[model samples]
Target: MMKTFLIYAYSAILVLGSLPQLRQAKKIPDQPFARKAKSIYRTPATVSRRVIEKTKSTVTVSGHEKIPDQPVLFVANHQGIFDILVLLAYLDKPIAFIAKREIKRIPIISKWMEQIKCVFIDRSNRRAAIKVIDDGVESIKAGQSMVIFPEGTRSKGTNVQPFKSGSLRLGTRAEVPIVPITINGTYKMLEEDGGRIKAADIELIVGDPIYPEQYQGIKHNQLASDIQEIIINSID
Candidate 1:
């Protein structure tokens, strides 16, 4: 219990302390913003790795070399809150997330997410959600990679949930490659024990990227199911 408290406390301090840097990076011009944001990512990445170590957990990542050089849409199964931390800490690239609108309410954390170009979607409002998708596509086309948890919520276990096909538009509309990632064991870190943090071995598997040409003619629903199956089968 104390460990969990310390983790949150430390994370809060880290986010608060990075305000000056975030503000400075936010001033960069649009043409150079992506480069500046990538450099700024190191701060959050370090903080994420430190927090994971504080939990006394081990992460085994595989197939990361499969990620392409261009900005691609990362579609991953949602296992828990730590899923984001794991990706931020371990992935060797700078990427933003398509997060829920509620997260935008977070104080300093939301500012940092905005610095990284994260798109927040209001799932309850159809028109607003469509706008969010369009914004995400533009961000991807502008050379900023993004991640989406199509399950729309954490499964809290290894049982992968069905992905909502609408989120796939970020990839299809941008004409970028779609990379499927499978995250297992994050739930045991927090959600499994009812919010108490615990030591757990986590696995993050990066499957082969599905290029635009490959998924060009497929329906979004079918594509969502295929990606879901890939994630489900990747788990132990």
Candidate 2:
């Protein structure tokens, strides 16, 4: 327990220590360093894969061939923090995620996230969320694919929560293909019962990609519901 706590404590300190850099990145969104910092964390994120695999975790990936080399929007259900790591470890293509703004406060990981071109959204402010989407659309146009968790937060259970239509606007506005991903066992590995992180094998199932053009003009709620159905079916 001491060792585990120490690891987390160290990670926390590292994350907290990078605040100045993060603030700088926030101010100069276009600076190369803003995005470059995110790549540095890939080394640690890679090590994280070894840690998961060391615990005998099993990951089964499907429909990867469907991932077109041409950029598209990848959407998935968020169950735990491990979801990102699992996807990163399994997917060979270089992609970034749309994450919560708070994660940008973390130490070295924040820089890596920015460097990787991940878009961070501040959900509390509607205007900020819209601005973030505008930026995401620009990122897609620039040829970088993005992953978003429509659930908005970790579900921490088997039941699929109602998808938020607000978040779907990004994919549709960007006019990129939407890839629905189903991630199971992540919540189990990082249970909400307590703060403890457990080691467990997780399953990642990717479904057929949905083209945004097909859903053009569709109501946001309907679009979200459709995506949610597709993701849930992929899991089963």
Candidate 3:
């Protein structure tokens, strides 16, 4: 328990200590979106690495090279908070997440998310949720990849839950590729420990991209089932 506390204390220190990096956002006053993406990603990426190392967890990744250069939608199952840390640390390109609206109130962390183009969905409000989807579509067109946890909430590393079909539209509507991601073992880190942190091995599998053109007439729920099957099969 003490170890977990110290690790999180270190995280808070890291986030607060690195706050100055936000000022670098203006370095190239008229910079393009890609350069700005780098500025937004740099510090968070470093912090994610540090957090993973501090947790004493090892993440084994496979097929990361399959991730395309062009903007694509990442459809991954949610495990827990560490799932986000692992992705931010290892995924090669700049990617933003579609997260819950409540997370936007988190100090310092939320500010960084805004800069990275994260879209916060208010699930309770249909209009707001639609607006979030529109925002995600715009972000992808402007050159940033996005990740959606279609399960809507983390399963805490247990059996994967059914995916909600609506979240898949961010990729489909944008006409970008949808990449299925399979994650396992994250539940053992904190959730399994009753909120305490423990070291564990995590496996991340990146499946092939599903191009929009290939499924022109398919229903969203059917597509969700197919991707869910892919993720379930990929897990250890």
Candidate 4:
């Protein structure tokens, strides 16, 4: 228990210590979008890698080759906090996420999230949610990849829930390919570990992209369900 607590402490220090650099990243004038994004994401990515290693988790990623070169929407399962960590540490692409609005209330952390182009939605407010999705579509149209957990929240276990089909509009409207992803065993790293870090064999599988063109005559909700099934089958 002491060792686990120490690891958490160390990670907190690393996060807090990086705030200065984060501020600098926010201030650089006239830098390219990608460069500024990398700056904003670098510290968090380092922290994610360290936390994963400290917990002794082993991540296996397959089918990432299916991801296209251009910005694509990653439709993935959410099992636990470790899901975010795994993606930040292992995925080859630079992408942002659509997160819940409450998280955006955090001061410095939220600043970093915004800088990295993360879109936060107020799910309770229908109009606001639509606006957020519209913004995400714009981001994708601007050549930036984005991730959305259509499950709306973490399942925290093995059973993947039915997706909220409306969320796939971000991909369809933006004309970006939707890459369905499956994540397994992340819940074991935290939720099933008695609320502490522990070694777990986690897997992330990236499935083939569903191009917007393929949905030319289909309903967006059907596209959402199809991708949801693909993700379910990809899980170990």
Q: Which candidate is the best by lDDT?
A: 1
The residue-by-residue lDDT of candidate 2 on 1-236, one tens digit each, is 55446556754664565566555555654544324434443454554566456445677777788887666778789888778878877765557788889988865676767666788988798898888888888777766677888788788876788887776766787787878888988876656546566666677777787786678778989978988998787667
Poorly placed runs, candidate 2 (over 4 Å): 6-45
lDDT of 4 by residue, 1-236 (tens): 77668877987887788799788877864245655565566777887888888888899999989999888899898998889878888886778888889998777777777777789988889999999989898777766788888888889898899899888888888888889889999999878867876789999898988887787778978888888888887774
RMSD versus native structure for model 4: 1.8
Deviation from native of the Cα of residue 200 in model 1, angstroms: 1.0
RMSD of each: 1.1, 4.5, 1.4, 1.8
Best by TM-score: 1
Q: Which parts of model 3 have CA positions greater than 4 angstroms off?
A: 26-31
**For model 4, the run of ten residues with the poorest summed lDDT:** 29-38
Candidate 3 residue-wise lDDT, 55-147, digit = tens: 889989999999987899999998988999888987767889998899999998888887788999888999999999999998888878899
Q: What order do candidates take by lDDT, descending?
A: 1, 3, 4, 2
User: In model 2, which range of ten residues has the least summed lDDT?
Assistant: 32-41
TM-score, every prediction: 0.97, 0.80, 0.95, 0.92
Q: Which residue pairs does candidate 3 place in steric collision?
A: none
lDDT scores in order = 0.90, 0.72, 0.87, 0.83
